[model samples]
Target: MKFDAILDPDSSPHEVCELGLLAESYGLNAVWTSNYPSSRDPFINLCPLALASSRIRLGPLVVTPYEMHPYKIAKALASLNELCGGRANILTGGPTGVNATMGMDFSRMVGRTRECVEILKRANPDEALNYEGNIYQVRGYKPTWATDEPPFIYIGANKKQMTHMATGIADGLMLGDTTERRLGSSLRLIEDNLATHGRSRDDLAVSCLIAWHVKEDKKLSSSEAKRHLALRGMLDIWFLETFLDAEECKIVDANRANIFTAYKQKTDVIEGVPDAIVDKLVENLSMSGDYDDIDGHIETLKRYRDMGLDEVAFKLHEDQAAAISVIGERILPAFQSH
Candidate 1:
C-alpha cells in the first residue's frame, strides 16, 4: 500500500512546498491539502508544492459541488494537474456541516455529489461539455487550455448509497475516519457495487483518512488526540459502535457538546465524559501515542493494506514536519519494499 500525507491547510504555500519536497525525498506517494472553510484555497495552496515536487501526487480534499460548480473545480484541478505533470487529484463530496454555516444547502447531497462527479469526468479540453443533471449542468463549456490528462477524481464517500454511486462513476472512493472493524464491510460493499456495475476492483482506488497524532512525548500525543476526538467521524454512532457498546455510545452521544467544547477549546479535559471513553475513541479511530507506538501503527497500516486499501492518507496534526520525518523514516520503509 502507498502512504500519503494530508497537510493542515494553515501551512503557507512555501511551507507546503518545503514539506512536499521532504515527503518526495522520503519516497512517500502523495501530499494532500485539507479543504477547510477558513483556510487558504486548497488548490492554490498546492501551487508552490506542485511546481517544486516531481513525483508526489497533490490536490485539494473534499471540494463540494454546492460551494463551487464542478466546472470551476475542474478548471482549477486541471491547471494544478498540469503544474504537477499530471499527478494531481481531486476528492469531491456533499456539503459539509461546517461549510453549511456559510449558507450552503445540504439537502440532495448524494445527487449533487453524483452529478458533480459525472460533470467532472467529462470536463475535458478535447470537447465542449454539454450535459444536464438534476443538480448541475454545463452547456458547451470547454477549457481549450486544459490539455493535460485529467486528474484523478475521487468521491469522498463512507456510506452505502454514496459508495455504490462512486463505484459506478468516480475514479476512486475516499473513506473518511473508517476503522478496522468497519473497513471490511465498506470494501465488501464496494466490491459488490463494482460487480453490479461490471467494473473490477482495480478500476477504483480506495483510500481512508486516518488521524496521526504521535509526538516525542506520550502525554502530549494522547492529549492532542483527546482534544481532537470529536473529529473522528464527528463521533458518529456508526463509528462509535465499532468499539463502544450501546450504553457507551449513548454516553458519547449525550456528551457530544462537551466533546465539541473541548475540541474547540483545544483542551484535553472533556467536562462531561469519562477519560476512559475518550481514550477508547482515540485508540480505535486514530494512530496515536509516542515514538515507541510506531511499530504498532505500522501493523495497523499493514492490515489496512491486506484488507485492500490502495492508499492511506494520514492527517497530521502538530509538528507536521517531524511527523513526516517519522513516517518517512520508519513507517514508509515497511511498505515501500512490497
Candidate 2:
C-alpha cells in the first residue's frame, strides 16, 4: 500500500506546496491536488511542488472533463511531467454535481470524458496531435519541450460501462467512496467486466481512495470521522451506501433518514449525534484510530492487495502535515514491511 496526501480546497497554494514537501520528506508516493470549485487551479498549485520536490509525483486526484477540454489537460500534464522530469500523473473523472456549483453542465460529462481520454492517448509529448471527437477537437496540437513521454492517464470511475471502458483504455483506475468490506465486491465487478472484454486484471492498475483520520485522542478521532462522513455522505449518499452490507445499510439508512428529518425540523444534526453514534458511524465507514494502532488498517489493505489492488491512496481528513507525518511514520512503514 502506498500513501498519498490529498490537497484540501481550503488550503492555499503555498500551503499545498508546503504539504507536498512535507509529504515527500515523509516518504509518501505522491501528492494529489483535488479539483473542486473551492480549490486553486490544480496545475497552477502543483507547479511549485514540481519545483520543490525532485521525485514525488504530483497531479490532480481528478480533473473533470466538463471543466476543461482534453487537449488543454494533456498540454498541462505534459508540461508538468516535463518540469518534474517525468514524474507526473493525470487522474481524470466525469463531471459531478459539484461542478454545477461552478456553473458547469453535468449532462454530457461522461461522454466528454470518454472523448477526451481518446484524444489524450493519441497525444505525444512533442509530436503534433490532430484530433476530432464529439466533444473536443485539436489541430496541430503539440508540446514544446522533449524530456519525457506523456504522463500515464487514469480514470476515476464507478459505473460498469465506465469501468469497462477504463479497463480497455486507461493505464490505471481510481476507486472512490470505498470501505474494506465493499472493496472485494467492487473488484469482482470490474474483473467480471474485464473478462467479458477479453482482458485480465493484470492489464489494469487499481487504486482506491479511502477516508481515514488518525489521532492520539480516540474521542477526537471519532468526532473527526463523523464530520468527515457527514460531509462526504451528503455529497455522495448513494455511493457511500454501496459500501455497507445489507444489515449495515439498514442502520445507515435509518440514521440518514433521521439526520434528514432533523434537518427538516430545523435541528442541528451534529448536535443530535452522540459520541457513541459517531463512533459506530466511524467503525462502519472509515479507518480511524491512533497512528500506532493501525494493525487493523494494515490488514484491511492486505485484503485489498489480495483483491488485485496496485496501490491505495489514503484520503486524510485532518491537517496536511499531521496526515503526512502519521502516514509516513506509521502507515507506510507498516505496510511496506508487511
Candidate 3:
C-alpha cells in the first residue's frame, strides 16, 4: 500500500509546501488538505506545494458541490493541475462538512453528490462541456489551457448508494475516518458492485483518512487526540457502534452536541461527555499516541494493507514535522513495495 499525508485546513501554505517537499523525498504518493468553509481557499493554498514538489501529488478532499458549482470545481482543479504538472487529485462529494461548518443542509445528498462526481469525472481542459444533469448544467465553456492532464477524480463516500455510484464511475473511493473492520465491510460492498458493473479493481484506488498524532511527548499526543477527537466522524452512531455498546452509543449520541462544543471552542474539556468515553473515541477512531506507539500504528496500518487498501491518508494534527520525519523513516519503508 502507498502512504500519503493529509493536512488539516488550518495549516499554512508554507507548512503545506515544506511538508509536501519532505513527503516527496520520503516517497509518499500524494498530499491533500482538508476543505472547509473557514479555511484558506483550497486551490490557492495548494499552489505553493504543487510548485515546490515534483513527485508528490496534491489536491483537496471532500469538496462539496453545494458550496460551489461543479463547473467551478473543475476549473479550480484544472488550474491547480496545470501548476502541478497534472499531479492533482480530488475527492468530490456531498456537503458533509459544509453542513456542520457552514450550516448547509444535506437533505438530498446522494443525488447531489452523484451529479457533482459525474461532472468532475467529465472535466476536461482540452474541450468544452455541454453537460446537463438534474442538479447541475454546464454549457459554452471548454477548459483550454491545461497541457498535462486532468486531475484523478475520486468520489468521497461512506453509505451504500454513493459507494455504488463511486465504484462504477469514479477513479477511486475516498472513505473518511473508518475503522479496519468497517473498512473491510465497505470494501466488500464496493467490490461486489465492481464485479456487477464489470469494473476492474486495478483501475480504482481505495484510500482512507486516518487522523494522526504521534508526538514524542505522550501527554501532548493524547491531548491533541482529545482536542481533535470530536471530529471523528462527528460521533456518528454507525461509526461509534464498531467500538461502543448500545447504552454507551446512546450516551455518546446524547452527548454529540458536547463533542461539537469541544471542537468549536477549541478546548479539550468536554463538559458533558465523560473522559473515559472521550478517550475511547480517540483510541478507536484515530492513529493516536506517542512515538513508542508508532509500532502499533504500523501494525494497524499493515492490517489496512492486508485488507487491500491502495493508500492511507494520514491526517496530521500537531508536531507535524516530527510526525513527517517518523513516517518518512519508519512507516514508508514498511509499506514500500520492492
Each candidate's clash count? 0, 0, 1
For candidate 1, write residues 1-338 as lDDT tens digits.
88889998688898889999999999888888888878788999999999888888888887888788887887788889989888999889877754665885678888988888888888887899998888688899788887777799889888888888999999979898988988999999999999999999999999999999999999999998999888889887888898999999999999999998998899999987887888899899999999999999999888889999888889988899999999999998898778
TM-score of every model versus the real structure: 0.98, 0.86, 0.95
Off by over 4 Å in 2: 196-198, 231-278
Regions more than 4 Å wrong, model 1: none
Find the candidate with the highest lDDT and give its number.
Answer: 1
Rank by lDDT (best first): 1, 3, 2
RMSD of each: 1.1, 3.6, 1.5
- The 10-residue segment with the lowest total lDDT in model 2: 263-272
By TM-score: ranked, best first: 1, 3, 2
Q: Which ten residues in a row have the lowest lDDT in candidate 3?
A: 94-103
